[model samples]
Structure formats: C-alpha cells, structure tokens
Target: MGYNTFHTEGDMEVEVEVEEADQSASSGMAKQAVVENVALANALVKDGGYSWTSPSSLKLYPIIMLITLNTAMNGYDGSLMSSMNAMPAFHDYFNVGKQGPATGLLFAIYTVGQLIGSLFAAPAADRLGRRFGMCSGAFFIVIGTIIQATSKDIGQFMGGRFLIGFGVTVGCTSGPIYVVEVSPPSMRGLFGGLYYSFGYCAGALVASWTCYGTGKMLGDWSWRIPVIIQAFPAAIIFCTVWLLPESPRWQIANGQREKARSFFVEYHGNGNEDSAIVNLQMEEIERETNYDKELANNRWWDYRPLFSTRDRCFRMYLLILVGVFNKFVGGAVISYYLPVILDNIGIKSANEQLLINALNVVFSSVASVFGCFYVDKFGRRNLYLWGALLTGLCYIPMNVIAALAEGHVAKGTGYAFVAFIYLYGIFFSFCWMPLQTLYPAEILPNDIRAQGFAFQELMNGLASFINTYATPIALQRIGWRTYTIFLVLHFIYLGMLWWSIVETKGRSLEELEEIFSDPHPVKKSLEKHKIVLATGQGVKRKPSSNVNDDGFGNGCLNPRNKESLEKHKIVLATGQQSKWE
Candidate 1:
C-alpha cells in the first residue's frame, strides 16, 4: 500500500489497499509495507501501551544546543554591561560620576525597551512562525551590539543598551517556546535546564572576565572590548540558524502536517522502523487540535481570559508571584550591582572586585550544572522550596555581618560578606533560575504559553527596572543593611512557593491542562466525549474533571464547553503486514 491510500473509518479500523509493484520492486514494496505497520503501531500506543523509546535522530540535540547558545547571548548583554559601568575611565568618559539618577535612567530605559520587545515580539513567534521571529531577533542583537561598540557618549551608550535589551527580549521570550516545541517529553526538562544554565553561566563569565581584563588594561577601550566581544556569539547563532529545521510541532500546529511528517522521516531515519514513530507523532498532534482551536479563538488584546476563571486565575496569580519574587529576592539587583556593592564593602581595588565577581559566576555555574542533572528527579516544587529556604538562610548572616562591620567587626569581614554572597549565587542557580525558566513553560496551556510568558517577563523586567535604580539609592541610604531587606523578601517568596505552586513533573501538555483546569467543567466536558474511545477510557479517567470557581468569583472553565464535543483520537500504529485488504 502506498502512503496515500490509507484512511480511518471512525475509531474502529483503518482501510488500506495493497497494490502490486513492478516485478523487480515487489520485494521492496513488501518490506516497505511491513515497516509502515510497525511504525504506525508504536506511534498509536500512549503510556505503557508501548515499550519505552529514544529519539530516532541526533539532529534534535544540535538544534536545542544552538537555541541554548542563542539564549546565552541575552544573559551576556544584560550582565556584562553592569561590570563595565563601574570602570573609572569609562565612568569619566561617559560623565556618569556623581549623577546617580542618570545611571538609574540608563538601566531603566534598557528595561523599558525590553518590556516593549517582549510584549510585542512574543506573540509574533506564534503568528509569523518561529523561524522568522527568531531570525529577526538575532538581527536586532547584531545591530544593537554594533551600536554599543561605537557609542561616543553616555546617551549613545544607553541607546545601544536599550536596543540590545530589545533584541534579548525576543531571545528570552521565544527561546523557551522553541525548545519546548522541539523536544520529546522525557528529555524536555533537561534540555530546558541546559538553556538557562548555559545562559546564566555565560552572563557570569562575561561579567567576571570583562571586569578583570578591563581593570588591568587601564584604558577607555577596556569596557568597549567586552561589549564588542558579544557580537561574536550573535554572528555565530545567526549563521547556524539556517541549518536548523523548523519545529515539527509548530509546523503541525500551523496545519503543515505533510511537512511535519517529512521532517520526522528525515530526522528520525529511513527504515521500516520509522513508520510507527511517524504514526505515533501524528496521533499526538491530532489530540492537540482542540488546544489550537482554543488558542485561535483567544483575544490578543485582552489578557483577562488568562486570569478570568478560577483555576486559570490561580495559575496566573502563581505566575505573577514567581515572576516578581524571583527577581525581588535580590538576584537581579545583586547581579547588576555586584561591583558597586563590593566597592561599598571596602573592596576598593578594581582587580579584587573583578576577581570576586568571577568567583560568584563560578559558583553559579556549578549550581546550574547540578540542577540540570536532578531537576526532573527532585521535581519542580521541591527545588523551589529548598532553593528559597537556603537563599533566605544565607542572607541572614551576610546582613548581620554588614550591620556590624561598620562598628565592631574586623576588616576581614569583607571576605565573609563576599563568601556569603557567592554561596547565595550557588543557591540561586539550583532553585530560582531553573524554576523561573521551567515553571512558566509548565503551567500555561499551549494556546496562551507565549502570552503568559510575555506577562511573566514583563513583570520580571518591571521588577528589574525598579531594582536597577533602587539598589543604588538603597546603598546610598542604608550602607550594608540592604541585605536584610532581601532576607525578608526571600522568606516571603519561600512561603508562596510552598503554599501555591503545584507539581507538574511528568504530565503531558494536554494532561497538564486538565490537571490545572477547574475540575467541574472539565468533568462535564469529558463526559460528553466518553463514547469516543474504549481502550483509552482509562486514559481519560486520569485527567481531573472537577471544576471550581476561581477565587475572584469567575468560573475557570469557559461555559461554552466546546472541547467536550471533539471526536475521539484514532490510534494507528503499523504492525506485521496482513493479508486482509
């Protein structure tokens, strides 16, 4: 049977017509038929119905690696400039000394640019296609980096930074969605972790090395050198993007099923073995059409639907808490203002300050490596809880040292303060960084994933904007006591994580929608579709059907109830060739 002749009749059976090939080709045709049947069978079975399997091709990994590198450039641009801001020659050349508000303005304006980019560019990823949106983002980064390298004054420098932030906003917004769409379920968490881990590590490394080298060089070009080096990664990612295949899921969602199937074949390998894999993917895609329908009907302008219902509202509230608290616990303020903070603590030598910053980056890199291996095993909520607690604990001693160092503490306490801060970075890597990246992807339904993430980033950028300026003002007023304020915020964030966040360890995207949805409407909707399948009845039962009112007094499930009316999915994996027509 050729691929085109097969069709499904309801859920019961599939019909295929076997045709004889040329005399020399008959054996090849028989082999192809057998291959298709096995592939189809493996593809159809979900959960324990089929044996476990791995991805058929290695191409998927490189695509993920490139996206990770792309995301890392965002971190590099955001953090590297912070250390440069402290350079003496650069400070005099830009006329920023004694002008605290101007420094704050520079940071705030860049964030404002990022806010605009994330809010606008994210949705286009879904609308225009991932490939086009990502390529455009890379182009912006290259332009922004060039502007920064050539800036003649502070105003020009800020302008360049703003453009860089704008470009990075696309990377932060689209990178997660792209990685999630391309990865298989089993390895999703690991791949996603690698993206953030590498990005953060890159940011830290750039900050450390740039600060050290620029301080030693003792010239105006010291800072310019680091800013210019950023262009290298931007160029490499742009060139490599042409080699990546479009995300198969995105293609499928866009109604390019033939293209998606062909992509799977090209990547998965050519053999009788691949037919089952192709059919299975097709089934999964078929199951997700309703998700696409919901997304299509969503209003782009009004974000109220995200928080309109009980469960969704709860999820929205959780997302907001995570977004704000993640930045508020002092990670952004510390990272962006580390050199200044070190200066205030009596580490006057620029070389010492740069070395300390490098040490902090090293600790964070180690933590990220640990997190990549164990995030799935430990689960999301557990890590958040522990990360928050440890981070809060680390802050207490540092705050105490800061308070006492002014009067009674010895000079060596500066070393203690720096050590505690590095420990804080380690905890942040294991807990907050991973969860910030992981939770946003896990909590939202596919239709709203991009928008939900955009909102999260908006809040994060807003918090960071406040912190960027607020840290300097706080330091001017409180000296070292600012660490105490962070201590209190970390505890507050810990409580929120323990009480509100839900576990989403192994759930598929559809199952996640049901698990997090209001059970009542979901139950009512699923009941209507109960007759669609017999074998998968048990599968349906696993999804929670209870609906509850959103705490804000709105129903979480839409009263329209369109999902229940959808047809049951037909599972068709290939097996040994049969004589029946």
Candidate 2:
C-alpha cells in the first residue's frame, strides 16, 4: 500500500502526482468495496478532479444520482395519485370521489406515516450510517410497493401508502445529508439541488406518462401498474446503494478514520493521497467532530446542544423556516391536487389532465436544471428572494383567472389558467424545489444535521398533510376561491424569505459554522469573501471573489486546534491505513 503524508495545517500548499493500484489483504465485502472504489477513482477522478467529466467526479455523480431517487419516489407518488384521481377506472375500483373526505384520508395517511417515520430517521441515519438509513428506507418502499400493487382492499392499500410514505421520509432525510458531505464544496448546491430538481421531475414525468397509458385500461390494472412501478427506483436503491462509498465525514466522526482517509484520497483527490484540498477538509472534519463530541459530554441526548447558544437557536429557527416554508408555500396544491385544480377551471378530460401533468413536469424539470446549475452563481438567498417574488406574484393572476373562468366559461380562460399554472410551476421549480434539500443540508451542523433533516421531514409532512387533506374539501366547498388562501401564503412566504434566509453559495460545511456564529448570520453570509479554499493553489482555480484569509493567503482565518493540538491527536501512518481509534 502507498499513501502520501498530508501536512494540511500549513501556509505552503503541497501537491503531488499520484498513481495507486492497491488491493489489500481484505476479502469479501470490504475488499470488494475497496477494489470497486479504486476502479471508480481511476475511471472518474484522475483526468480532472473538478471537471464534471473527471474520473473521480464521474464516480461521485452516479452516487448522487442514485440517491436522488429518494426524492423521485415522492414525486412519483404525487403525480401518480393525481393522475389516478382523474382516472375513471381508478375511481370505480377504489369507490373514491375526487373531492371529499375519502381522498383526504387516503392522501393524508401518507403524510401521517412520514411524521411517524421522521421520529426514527434521525437515529437510523446517525447510528447505522447514511447508506444503511437510505437502504432501510428503500427496503420499506419495496415492501410497500408490493402491497400497494397487490392490494385487495382499501385497508391494505392505505397500509401500503403509509409504509411508502415512511420510507420516503427516511430516504429523503439521509440522502441529502450524504450528498452534502460527499459533493465538491463549490458545486454542493448543484448536486444537492439535483435531489428535488431533476430527480423529482424525472419521477413525475414517468408517473404521469404511466398513468396516461394506463388510463386507457378497463380494469384495476390501470392504477395497479403505476403503483407497482413505484418499486422500480426503490428496488434499485435497496439493492445497489450499499455498493457506494459511505460519507467520509460520517466515517471520520464514527471512528472509521482510515476508510474516511481512503475515500478522500481516492474520490476527492483522484487517488492522490496528499491532495491539499482533501486534507484541509479532513482536518476540519476531525477538528469539529471532536469539539462537538466533547461539548456534548456533559449531558447526552438531552437536546440542549441544539439550543445551547443563541447562534444554534438561530440555526434552529432557520431549519424551521426551511422545513415549514417548503410545504406551506403551496407547492403541494399543485403537486398532488393539480388534476382537481384543472377541473375547476374547465379542463375535465382525464387524458388531457395526465398529458398536461407530464408536460408540466417536463417544463418544471427544465427550470430545475437551470436553477441547479446557476444556484451557486446566483446564491441561495438571492434565488429564494426572486423565486418568492415571482411565484408569489403569480398566485394573484391565477386566483383572478380561476375566479373568472369558474366552470370553463370560455377556451381563453382555460388557456390563460394553464399558462399561469405553468409559470407558477416553473418559478417554484426554479427556486424552492431545488433548495428544499440543499439549503437545509448546508445550514444544519453535522451534529444535528441528520436530526434536523428529520425535523424538516416532520414539518414537511405536517404541512403537506394539511394541504393534501384540506385541498379536496376546500376545492369542493369554496370552488375557485381556494386559490386565495395559497395566494396569501405566498405573500407571507416572500416576506419571511426576505427576512431570514442566508446565502450558503460559496462556503464549505465547516466554513458555515463561523458564519452562523456571527450575531447576524444573514449579513455575514451575504459577504462576498469566505474561507472555503475550494480552488486556487494546487486545485483547479480560486473563487472569483477574493478570499479574506489569515495573511498567509491559504485562508486559515480561524486557526482551529490551537489550544487542543497537544491534547487531541490525529494519528497518521505511512504505507498502511491509519485508523483513528
């Protein structure tokens, strides 16, 4: 075995060319993982570390892509359920009406299951590891999909929906966390955004088309087919997810230091063990991980650390803001209930509704992809502000048009409503959908990040439950007037977006800690200069905005471990894997 020594905490940057073909003494699962990772590193990471086409980067992308399916499954459910509601065969089979308590209970149960699952997702992610948590979630979905497809009664069908919902919460909670820890710091937004962006869109696209094809069927197969196919992504996740490398940060914090180091070397450094960028991140991970652990020694699992200081409590507030705003902004109204919404504005044909749903997903996907790429450039805070402004404003016109065109008075009204809905969908996809997982992953600290995601899922589930359960009844009772409520919500969301959201565009996981530490995190986060050290030196290139650093120009602004350097040691070994324990 060959490994390079990393002198990470220094002014001078060390760059070394690397070539490694190590196949250690290990056998079976562990050895297979090592060999596979080496192939992935050489094939994906070697050519250009930062480039999307780079060997290691390509290797990393597939991992992110697979995990994106977590969000895709949720999208699949939303689009599938909406299409099913429009299907005559489905309505006949289930004996459920479009607008009533029956649809509400069926839909609300999923969110209820998500709430229950949120309670366990954090512990699963933290204790068993991110990959395991994701896999466990996928496993439940596989079972749920089987049950849902084979359901002989409403009870069984609802039971399956609950399981699927629970599974989605768990997968969603951990998958984004894994992406954040593994993604390249500068491009974290793009990869993180992919979760609910193209991922969700892809799922929606498939489900809508599937429903359109099945809507022509004469029997229960119409709904069963879509429900059965829900297992496709979940099955893939359950079977293949373990083959991917675990989060290196998770490994380091949990005492698998050698494996963590190898991941950084192979994946992050393209097999160059001494990669400066990789080492800096590893050092920071070790530093903060230990400090957080020590800080919690006084009282374990009391939940005090989250509210231990003003800064942390502020982070909590941000978490709540993100969690609640994501669902409350009325995206749920479009997601699961769009078919019914279309009916109010005079488009009653099931086929047309399914087709429009498919197209809407496609256009929204385009918007999400655009947002995913430009997110780091425009910044999270700016996107939220603009996205809120546009999407919020869209609701006013939508409400006016819906009210005027109630019962499909004219073709022009229907066309106009579609156009407004498209704009609303496009703008929401451009902003909130992409950031739903990305922003929370960035803002939450490592210690509470997993639980924070669970909290996010809880808030998301609660809000979505309220929306899904109330939408049908409200649409039936208030007619076109239901649009007024979400319109009002968009206004409140816009105000909150302007007030509290912070810019997480150009910073690393550790760098965000300092920003949050400031009295005004939003103000500090908006500053151009940050300490990510994402590029320059031996890496691809420096951040375009100049860095504010500690005179050495290497950006060691907050020199950590100055006091505990002697007390806490990171044992490094040459020619062999170094396990921290």
Candidates in order have lDDT scores of: 0.62, 0.73
Tens digits of per-residue lDDT, candidate 2, 101-164, equal 8999998999998999998898889888999889999998999989889998888999999999
Model 1: which ten-residue window has the lowest total lDDT? 548-557
TM-score of 2: 0.84
User: How many clashes (backbone N, Cα, C below 3 Å) per candidate?
Assistant: 20, 7
Residue by residue across 1-581, what tens digits does model 1's lDDT show?
A: 34222222112122222334322223322211111122222233222122123244355667777787667776676567666666777777887742266777877777877787877665667676666566767777788888888999877887887877777777667777777766555455677787788765776587567767776786778888888878777677677776777777777777888787877665543322345444545555556565557546445666766775677777778788878767778776668777766666667676777777777887888888688766756667778889899989988888887777763555588888888898998988877676666678777766667777778878777877888777777877777777778888889888877777676654334445544554443233222111111122111111123222110001112322334322212122133221111
User: Which parts of model 1 have CA positions greater than 4 angstroms off?
Assistant: 1-57, 264-281, 407-409, 518-581
Q: How do the predictions measure up, each by TM-score?
A: 0.78, 0.84
Q: Which stretches of candidate 2 lie over 4 Å from their true place?
A: 1-49, 297-304, 530-581
